[model samples]
Target: MTEIEFQKNFSQLQYHLYTSPLPHVSNLHPHQKTIHAFFMLDHLREELQRKNESTLKTVNAKDFNLPEELHVYHSLYPLDQRQEKSIKIFGYPSWVYKSVCSVDGRVYCLRRIEGFRLTNEIAMSTIENWRRIRHANIVSIREAFTTKAFGDHSLVFVYDYHPLSQTLFDKHFSSSSLQANNHPQSGGTGVVVPETVLWSYITQLASAIKTIHSSGLAARMIEPTKILSTNKNRIRINCCGIMDMLTFDGGKNIHHFQQEDLIHFGQLIISLACNSLSSVLNLPKSIDYISRHYSPDFKNVILYLLNKPTPTKSVDKVIAMIGPRILHEINSVHHYNDFLESELSQELENGRLVRLLCKFGFINERPEFDMDPSWSETGDRYLIKLFRDYVFHQVDENGYPVVDMAHVLMCLNKLDAGVDERIMLVSRDEQSCLIVSYKEIKNCIDSAFRDLSRRK
Candidate 1:
């Protein structure tokens, strides 16, 4: 068989395979799965379009007292609702803003440390080392520089922007009790995060820390507020390399810092488990809570990280303990990949149909072609006109419009595939008719389009 014929048969087979009812599986209708997949893709398209539009939208710079330019970045908009003095983490009152990079026209998250003086010029060089560190769970830092545009001496660090992302603290701890109270999984005790989800977080954090330590650097900040949830259960370590720049001492104690990273990692997890940042203060109660709620492996992982600093205690040890959990996370990732590929296939089909429709819109009902008034009314072009009417301008016996979407889709699909199925095309006057196959109409469209393009 020809390629077109083979494709047509294969498409039919695939449709049947997806839609066919199976007695062994369950009692489901033939078209249920197909319709669900179609609508799921439709919703996904809408979500993606909204996100893209939101990212591309620019706010009025005049509305706020914003800087016109800051080292190749412009159009700065404050991400925080209120510019409260938050000196807990960075020691300096920091502000986050979304700005467009003038050089590349891409948006980046600019973290400005307000009134931070550059005591040592070597501190700025630490960002270069961070620029080399890239991992899936780490929000890669672009660059850092000092600017006086904000009416003060400010140190700015550029990082990638994830639209509509929330901090781990904001999503979980800030309103943990409310979410847990409303959640069906939580039996109303509040702050009941699932053990599996905690495992996922543990594995992802370990992976990121391993990458950081391997690059001869350390993730000095690993708090809930410093991590962002870009999507559901998907997180990335935010504000990396800022501490190194802020606390730049001439003598470097990489080992001590790395050990502090482990301790902080353990405390973050404990705080998340106990549903309070103060959980680290009372280790006995927190350990008892973890013991009662979580598995032994999880408890052991926490215990290992919370232990006193030693020569052998490292992120590698944590990884070795959670080996099977890491495997489970990988398996989940593979399943998610499969689901995305299936959704992507549906989108590919949509893109093809859109192109086909665009081609029809370009060729059909031309007012004039090659300066010939009767060009579209004569020869093969006339057949295309009749085919358009057959697809869209259909009427019933009572002269009422028949708005059948299924018929329109079927005709378009057949035309795109160039199938051998023939149909009768009637003129506007109803005095003449011509029989032709989709394959012939397809050739007519190509020939007419090519003929039009060769002009001038």
Candidate 2:
């Protein structure tokens, strides 16, 4: 993805993580929650600015305190927004980040915790235990250190950045006309998911869970949104490790909760086939449509997983039931394509980028129709507006985003990075005119948003 597109997607991801309704948080009034959310956002922006502006010097072992400092760069995006809310990792509510390592110019993901009164011994021991875990499907915490650099008591654990993603939620909920309006089981005029694909996804995920189970760990959240799809028909579970911290609430080990994980996984499979979870568990008969499309064997396995009374089966057995792929090989490959255009979609797409860029003074076309993208303020703004207006849809004031990141990323990937067009910028504050190229403006927009957002 282009830098601009990645920032957009990152913004959307933060929106999802932040807007997740905390209905259980009854103590705070609605306005208070909104205020708190914005406050948390400010904290995130400030921390990001500090990290971005600070000089990232190399680590010195003799004089270096890994806890105090280890030159971290390009981690301007703060994963934590609402500090008042306890976000969990493996059951521990901690902050997480996508960071660039100054030492080796490699990117990494880190989980953060305000280590208030936390001891290094406990932190190191936890990190060591996590490093011992070896699972292809599960993300493991590799390195850790304590730092008061940002504030009081901050413990950070770093992990590899696995960006392979197309959340299970989007795979089913995407605006692709075929997937949206054509699921046969969902009464759409389309065939149900190929048995091969369904079985493949389940088999791969089952193996991953099996490994975690063997290690005596349960992926507490196994729903569609929490799972990520990668190359080779693989799906990795995300947002783990903090469930126990949340569920246990520092109380005690809860073994039966593991069964809850199994139950959630079964629901995921059903949702995948059915397309929606409307009256699923209450009426076991709701699953009849699945049987109609899939084979009796497939239906039976799904029913067994969904049926609680029947003895729970292991992942190995689940795979055994759907033994080797004998038929229906999928030779067709999938690619991200969102280029198709509709008036509403185009308007929505343009509106967001237009208004957003206009706020930054990048738009100078007077907001009229029949305008060429290059006529805009800069190549960056011109290209951004052109792409947005032509490709994506406009969202309502309070509406959630309808355009998917895959679509944005796909369109961005097709762009000619070498193309450069110049545009003039007359700053509103200074009225000073400056000649700049599209590429330069596009790169500066992220920093502009960061600086402007803080002022707001």
Candidate 3:
């Protein structure tokens, strides 16, 4: 996406998230607030897709034109044999490419299905059904269009892309260190995934399933390749709408497919635990090993999901077994560039970022006069800009990112994105002066007495 378009979409997302939500309640838990923000964003996505439908009608799939906002990145391809095979199946060759939604500045995956016979009706209907879904743990669909192929029309689906995403299957089983750690007797105790992170993934997947089931949808695509691990060890179910669309003309009941989804999900969970790709073939042994290493509760849950009869198994039951978990880390992006973009946008919208910074004590160490109401507006503004730089930009003489304010804004300066967002500080002087906020500005007019009391 171009800089201008990205800034616009980024600003809109910020307004939705950082603002005091629609009803304006301040006491909501962080979980409630984030869920609400995700809901609003999901609703926004549905609305955009409806508007896109009209424009899509103007072109036939055989001679479709690439509209202005969707720029296809033709040069990107599968980096390895696994990826190539995954995107290409049944002897037909196809691939996924990167693209930018000039409209939203968000990166999207454009997967070309070479030989599918999708009537315009099925494509639109499938997209419409998918668009209504808004779960935070699901990879969202932006748009779907058809293109002309040599023998048929190809259906191309656009999906949200996460930077640095790797399949859960590859994450645990592909690496030597991880492989050795999962089998501790190998004498190479490598980086074992924290128990916290494993539990976190399990609970999040349960949440995603609950959301999907609530929508009366079955996620038939539940294998490891279809699950993506994002920054901060978060796992998201990918391809929410694809399998349903593929079966749109197949005449099978969705519930049948939904039950299959549960089967695969159970397989996926056990695969992670056992660190084996050929999980189903060793079902009995897998259960025995998991029972040996994990708790009785988890073992019971896995048995119910995989070995039990489908007529009796339940997702809610599994979730009840795993119980409740906090989802704050799932919402974060890992790359430094993404951090700066998300943080800078959060700060611009009504000072919640600044409020968070203050709560974390990054803004408490400023010079008294700069924060004092007696200072002229110009002086206060100058100090405020400097303080913003120090908190979000300045580095120490040791060449390390400062560790203040949750290390979010402070750490952004540690990467290349910092050069553009930060004030280009010369040295370490302003780290002592990070205090700044909109609260003080509001105090200048709304409550003089309050400000006077703060000073004392």
Selected candidate, larger TM-score, 1 vs 2 = 1
Could you give candidate 3's per-residue lDDT for residues 1-456 as a string of tens digits? Answer: 333543343212232434343566779776443323322344334445443432222222222233333334332322122333444322344555555555655456676666767654754676776678877678887777766633456667787766556777566766653645654322113343445566777777888888887777777667776688865466788766765665575434766666766677778777777666675677878788777667776667677777544766667777767764333334433354575565455435335444444432422333453356433223433443444455566468998866554344333223212223323322244344333233443332223223323644
Residue range 1-456, candidate 1, lDDT tens digits? 333543343212122233332245456587534334433354455556555654665555655567878899998877775546789999999988899998998999999999999989988888888899878999999999999998999999999998888888887666554465453222223556788889999999999999999887889888999999887788999999998989886437888888989999999898877777777888998889888888999899999999999999999999999999999999988998898788887556666677877767777877888878787778888999999999999899999999976677678878989999999999999999999999999898888878777857
Q: What TM-score against the true fold does each predicted structure earn?
A: 0.87, 0.47, 0.54
Candidate 3 accuracy as TM-score: 0.54
Model 1's TM-score against the true structure = 0.87
Residue-wise C-alpha lDDT for candidate 2, range 1-456, written one tens digit per residue: 234543444222242344342345667665343323312333344444444432232222222122333446444344333445443334344665566777887767676655543533533443444467766666665676667765566656677665434567667645473356565434322556667777777666776777766766666768776677744455777656544432333323434555666667777777777666442554455467676777788777776666563345565566677665422222222221132222224334444544544554534343432344343445344444444443355344686656654544333323324236664544434345566555654565554345334642
- Per lDDT, what order, best first? 1, 3, 2
The Cα RMSD of model 1 versus the native structure comes to 9.9
Candidate 3, superposed: residue stretches over 4 Å from native = 1-83, 87-94, 149-152, 175-194, 250-252, 324-456
Model-by-model lDDT, in order? 0.82, 0.53, 0.55
Task: Identify the runs in model 1 with alpha carbons over 4 angstroms from their true place.
Answer: 1-43, 176-191, 397-400
Give lDDT for model 1.
0.82
- In the order shown, what is each candidate's alpha-carbon RMSD? 9.9, 18.9, 15.3
